[model samples]
Target: MTKPLPPRNDRHKSSGGFSLIELMIAITLGLMIMTGLVTIFVKNSQARTEIERNNRQLESGRYAMNLLTEDLRMAGYFSSFNPDELVISVNAPPLGPNSAPVTPAMTARPDPCDTTVANLNNTYFFHVQGYDYPYTSAALPTCISDVRTGSDVLVIRRLATCVAGPTLEAGCDALPNGAPYFQASNCFQATELARNTGSRLDYLSHFVLNTDITLATLRTISCLTSFGAPAPAADYRRYLTHIYFVANNNVGSDGIPTLKRAELGAGGYTIVPLVEGIETIQFEYGIGNTANSAKIDAYTADPNTYNACASTACLLNWLHTYSVKVNLLARNVEQSPGWTDNKVYALGLKADGSANVFPASGTYGDRYKRHAYNAVVRLDNPSGRVTP
Candidate 1:
């Protein structure tokens, strides 16, 4: 009876479901919110990828810069032998039977991969050398098979800081028999004993620089060769020759510009990849004005002024290099999204007071982000031995 009374207000009834207009508006709002969320997700993902690439690029560039800079400081370390000792013999006039050896004609650059004993003997005077934009007539050794075009190559020669063998130190392993070993004479030979007028460094023939150690009769610090008793065998060190350059590929033509090191070993020159994404390496040499200068008087991009270096003079020019400016152009391994490397980046300094830019042109028209790392490293081993 109560429900029959309420049926009289049926014209004022409330709706129990959404109308078509309200449903359409609700669906449109839902789609807009989903689209915004998707856009945010995409932007975040891209931002994350860009951050990773930048971090990797930064690591590679700084590591390379530090490596080159630190190694450059250790360029001419040969245990007890200094370039100062070499300077006296090669420059002074012939004194006697144990005087300066006959020097060869000057070549602008020596082959970094030349492991032949003869070649080693000839170029041992130049402990450090660099080649700028090597190609055609200025090509490096054939051992360097993948040198990137328009990049510089650096050669560093030194001895192991620790002792090497015949006998082994606690940390270092003995070098194989055929590998080149060096033993400089702190104690002189019988020929040098007769003419005690000069120092041990006076004779150029006393050092064991070549691989042929059969007649390497140089002695240790102990001058124990009493008339008949044999002198103690010298503790020789592993002669290290490293050539650093930018190679076109890392492994099997990957197209990743890598900093490759061709290190001299028992077998010969062995190539190995170091830091990757190092697109270009350029060096500016800080040349000292005098033979014994410990400071940089002038800087030159090209040390191979062929006309300037003649015979022993050539050795002097390279020996006088007191410092090196290392410039490395490093880039991201992958292309950045919505990015263009149209900006000109300066690495080193130019003669006209501007910065030295890469690609040899105005800018790099590419998508990869790049950064330049540079450091001026002093040649401590060589420059320290000289008076400022």
Candidate 2:
């Protein structure tokens, strides 16, 4: 054997060619490329998640706002009473037996006070006996003036400059015959008194005479004092009314499970659920007039006093209107894509609760890689109307 000819030196040289420094450089470059690709993928995913969350928030806000607008616009609107005032009823006598009778006929008179048989001391009165108009025909209109369902005999009352009193003697009393009412006005051949059976009072408790009704009962009644024997010296004060909207607050850690129905009269206002992921809602009121540019202000518990110019008188001084601003904040409770990084957004809202500036943002979160939104909205139905 020629002794393997001293292993080829060329083979050894080939194996030793690559230096440590060159190997290190190659490895570093590969790692850098891999790192860049991973970062790009993460950012893209986060962005997509945020967009979806935002869309959901926007949709929910819009729907809620629309419903609120329609209802609020219809405030104070009734078919019978003028657009400015609404007529309602009371329970007890005006002041007392000597004070005023406040029967159905006396209170339900159409205008503040009409002299004719069809007319009475205003179309409103105070009848403790309650009004009992028979639904003789199915064709009868649904509502009687502002009062609809419920007890028929109520103390009729009105809100106006012309009509006056909680007095039973001149206005509230339906009749001096000790029957159950006093007359105020007459329209054409219309008579204020009705000749029903005496014993039927209990059975007829829920009935009302042929009367007018409109869209919703007047929320308040004011027993005004007057100089002309309850005529109009001291003006009629007001009662309060309010409405609340909410989802089925019954949502659990699992999620919202049911729909909520609106409750008509007043009672325990059901707590409503906001959007599934929404955390809060902020509101702003325009201190200026509806027609002009408004100066947005922080929301107050009592919007009327703050934005409505301090007092009822000042509030009503406007052209009968003001504007509203709203802000909605939504969150990804699930952080679906693990994109909970914080991002602050500055945005504006329209009358219908839609964000106009859209995805505005400020740096946020530990990674400084998240985004958020701030919205400002305007309310269209602000009538600058006094809460009274």
Candidate 3:
């Protein structure tokens, strides 16, 4: 205790803390490392954002193409009934009295939005109808609005491939209410089976294709054979009519171009937005010189105009369509930083750098990137049927 107070001042001086210059140098190095880390993080974030944008554009484009292909392939698919066998029926809904037999025929073009049984009957002739931009009609259909002026509109009509119930595609009916349905008869009358003239009117008399599924008169098996017992209920499929086109906006002026469809539902035509960022859609039809032939004789954008006849009695131009070439332009959802998109997207036609009707200038002078998708899809249901 006597000498503890006089501790060595020289020892304390030898173990002194860092000098001010050394401390400043360490701070500068730390700051440099931190700045490098920050720069790396920022670059990574930007790259990730760009990748996300690109993925969305690609996925949207692919999904839209698949959707169109699926529906187009099924066009004119009326379950057991062949549309080719449907001859001119004066007893069609429009011509005859209200008690007309429900045979398939078209007095006029069937409106895609029209869910009425009368117009539904008209699907026999109007399957796979398409109207290019500069539509032959003065205006677009009443139910479809905000259709991108330059984009194409395609109408696909068919019955659901599966039975209408809680499961299966196209139908999606837990309990069918007022939705249109198509049912085929499993039982054939002796008179019908014997003649086999293959006439549609005679054949359709055994089936029911109506908007009401709750009709009690529908029968799958012969009720006459049941003899006061219950007859088996025929499986019902929802009737699907789709008008697909591109819209200028996805929501309230969100500025996102989208692929949309007017679906024939219980409440008439329900407009539904499909894939977004689909800026344009176009189509080229491959028509055959002969009816129900697979060989393509001519290709045109306006099928009706290309294959017009002196009389309206001939087959509709759309009905002769055997293949369809689809073209879609998909744009990125977000603008890239300091990016300039001056690319010409050739959706269809010759790639001579010609100006397209979609962009009007052939090139999109914007910050968002765009890609074009194309497919030549065969209309299987219509093309596969070889009239014997």
TM-score against truth, every candidate: 0.82, 0.34, 0.82
Number of the top lDDT candidate: 1
**Candidate 3, superposed: residue stretches over 4 Å from native:** 1-9, 12-16, 88-108, 136-138, 165-172, 190-206, 214-233, 308-315, 350-358
Pull out the clashing pairs in model 3. none
State residue 212's C-alpha deviation in candidate 1, in Å: 5.5
Number of the candidate with higher lDDT, 2 or 3: 3
lDDT of each: 0.75, 0.31, 0.71
User: Against the hidden true structure, what lDDT does model 1 obtain?
Assistant: 0.75
lDDT of 3 by residue, 1-388 (tens): 5766665567546566999999999999999999999999999999999999999889999999999998888887877666555432232433333433443333345556666776665554456877777664455677887777678888888887677732345535453567777776655654432233454355445456676656524455664543765366657677778899998899979988889999887778888999999988888888775644568887777665664452333334566678999999888888988788877676675222233444767467779988899999988877777433
Give lDDT for model 3. 0.71
Candidate 2's C-alpha runs over 4 A off are 1-54, 83-242, 245-250, 253-262, 265-274, 285-301, 304-321, 336-338, 344-388
Candidate 1 residues 97-129, lDDT tens each?
233453434434567777887667556656688
